[model samples]
Target: MGRPRLGITSITLVKTLFLAALDAGAVYFAVVLAWQGSWGFLSFLLLGAGGVNFLLLSHKAYPLRYLFPGLFFLLLMVVVPVGYNIYLSFTNYSTGHILTKEEVIRVLTSREYAPTPPVRFPFYAFGTPEELYGVVLWPEAGPLLLWPDGRLASLEGHQVSDTDADGIPDVLDGRPRLSGRELLAHYGMLQALRVPWENGWLRLATLREFGYFLPQFLYDPEQDMLVDQRTGIQYRAGESGFYSPDG
Candidate 1:
């Protein structure tokens, strides 16, 4: 009788230690979930931890030894679907619903317009095909260096020489201008490059011409409408999407 009582005490001690360790892990997970603002997931973890502790520690739950199987199925049926739904709510789940309303408004408002009269300048492409190409624009204030990242620098005292005697300078700070053959070699990439400006972008119209481009559409938040600059068309936002007057 004495030996059996000692064995039961030892088993109870082991069970208590195991329960404590499990509870500690659950608390750690709860803290992490709370920090991440996942209150729903924290609540679920707490409920599961309580249920497991009750099943293992309570004498009244001894007859219901098969509770774990039921609990496992319950978690599968409830927790998985809940988590998946939460994930889907934060994603672009369907077509025509790609961006949130705020995100769409932000993108629309960032659209910029060019000046009333278009401004164009003569530019020469420099740098090898293997590197990012840079442009030298001949502004009224001598030559200006336009980096690939849209930064403008005045090359006033830089050794820019025009050996050809054309209006456009041929050399910039000792680097010879890229020839027409070199420009044509990387024509596709050069044409696609867009340099940022005050109100719009400077795009390569031709090998010698860099033209300023303005945003085609302008959005008004208060009116919730998009106005086309060239055609003077106003498109109002509807339940389906933006619709024109003709539509």
Candidate 2:
């Protein structure tokens, strides 16, 4: 055909090396995002994939050198972070160790609140699939109320009492249901609802107050400690994952 292509194997080897570099770079940035909990991890991953696509299609476009800058960026952002995390995994990087113990302890002792009883309400969800917008509630005890906007009214001919505070009467008489943002707002109403669903009411319970509950672990920078709300215990990094009452 065209002077019989020569050095084809060498060209293939160069292409392989470039692709491998891109893959390695992508993996690196992905790990970095995970470690740092950085916001742009997804962005870096996308960039890496884009780089691979660019390299693959470089020959099809004019001025192939234009793609080199992008390839360089992918290597720096993705490959470096991945390699760093791999290095971290080999050492005592977990709890009681230098780098991660504090965060581990903080998570073990976060505070949590139990929603009060009478929690269950006949509920529905709404919004444009992207964001949860709002909710409306009819209690089984108090009133047929649309919440969030606090729009309240009595459903015509339907009586709200101890049995059916949630205004959708036991008898369905063709009432148009709440939708859109109104449904999204229902979650808050679900939490705020004082009605008992089965047996438990939502209450703020920590080992410090209620003996039978647990806390969500969150970091307390000032105290320099991890508080376990479940067991009513606090663990310090120096204590090596052990929390004693006296300590």
Candidate 3:
């Protein structure tokens, strides 16, 4: 009888130590969650930890001895969703939901616009494959140099002349202009070139035409509204994850 009592005491001691270790791990997890500002998850963890310690350590709670099943179900109910939510917080979960407020502002402001009765110009491609340039020929405004930076300038003595009368200028600022064959070799890239114009962009519409385009929506941070550049319609950000004029 004495030996049996001693064995029982040793088993109880081991069980107490194991329960203490488990509770310590739970407390550590709760502290981490608190530090992360996840108050909701931290609350759930604390509750679960407290319940587990009480169930395992209390001698009067003999009927609650089968605590593993309850603990497993509690973990499923609490941990799974909290883990999934944490995963989503790091991802671009959806279209508008993906980016932060500052990122969205930067993206929206990058769009450009060309005013009504658009400023169109006849342009010619010039330069080597390493550096391509544009010269805009405004019928009444004379020739304006279109640099890659979107700057349109008229140089005092740098007038371009079509000496060969091929409708394309032969020389611009003493640099030989790219011929048909040379231009054709890099036609794909040259066609996609865009330069800044006023408050919008000047895009290569064709080999001869440059078109101006403007931003469709402009965000006003002060009023928290998206103003349509075309119609002047204002759309407020809605709680339903979209912008609407009605809101």
Candidate 4:
């Protein structure tokens, strides 16, 4: 009699689904990198992803399936980088000599400009110092519930009571409103709190307000400099990296 073949198991199905998801994500990311003109990193990503697919899915690579992953990452992360640095050592060490003028400009142009007349919203505090929550009133968007861990949600949908009808809700869900003095205790933790807004951030500007900030760095190709919006300073590429008015 011929040997019986095993049917597809639950574990095998889950593994197949997971691998498919991983490859799909890899393909999407590779496309993004290609569009961004990051060919060097894209090549590395493709090489690693291809190797992983071959090792995990191919019967021929079964022996090295587990071994290849660890080995491949070690080479990609450590060996390849160290070898590249060693190769760069053979070339001139000076930044101006090793890097092209455009490359220098690209490195110095890395800055973000916070828009003028920043978006500022008056916010009310809720919960407590240990676990804080806030409500920001935006003109167009109404009230937004801001959580301590950076979660943002529409306050209109959530159950909140306006006890005094002061426009600001007194109690959001079970968390009671906190007074300005009570909120003083939460000020330290609140400082670093930021919520995503307009591809930038909405962060605490003061105890009563939150403000929006975004990337605004403008690079002047003719001047070969990048302007800092905050300080209104222009910076050019120096021998080491950047030459700024502050320097």
Best by lDDT: 1
lDDT digits (tens) for residues 1-247 of candidate 3: 4554557788889888988888889888988998899999888888877777777778877677786787687779998889888888777683346666667667776766667787678767677756676555554456667765556777566757789898767777666787667767656664566765567777776666777788877887788877778878777766543366664
Q: Using Cα atoms with residue i matched to residue i, what is each candidate's TM-score against the true structure?
A: 0.55, 0.30, 0.51, 0.45
Query: For candidate 2, which ten residues in a row score worst on lDDT?
Result: 203-212
lDDT of 1 at 15: 88
Candidate 2 lDDT over 53-107, as tens digits, reads 6756577754655767876778689988898788777866643456366456554
Q: How many residue pairs clash in each candidate?
A: 0, 29, 7, 4
Where in model 2 is the C-alpha error above 4 Å? 1-90, 93-102, 105-133, 138-166, 169-175, 178-223, 237-242, 245-247
TM-score of 1: 0.55
Candidate 4: lDDT of 190?
74
lDDT of all the models against the reference?
Answer: 0.76, 0.49, 0.72, 0.75
Worst 10 residues of 3 by lDDT: 238-247
lDDT, candidate 2, residue 37?
81
Q: In model 4, what is the error at residue 50, expressed in angstroms?
A: 63
lDDT of candidate 2 vs native? 0.49
Off by over 4 Å in 4: 1-114, 137-139, 216-239, 242-247
Q: Compare candidates 3 and 4 on lDDT and give the better one.
A: 4
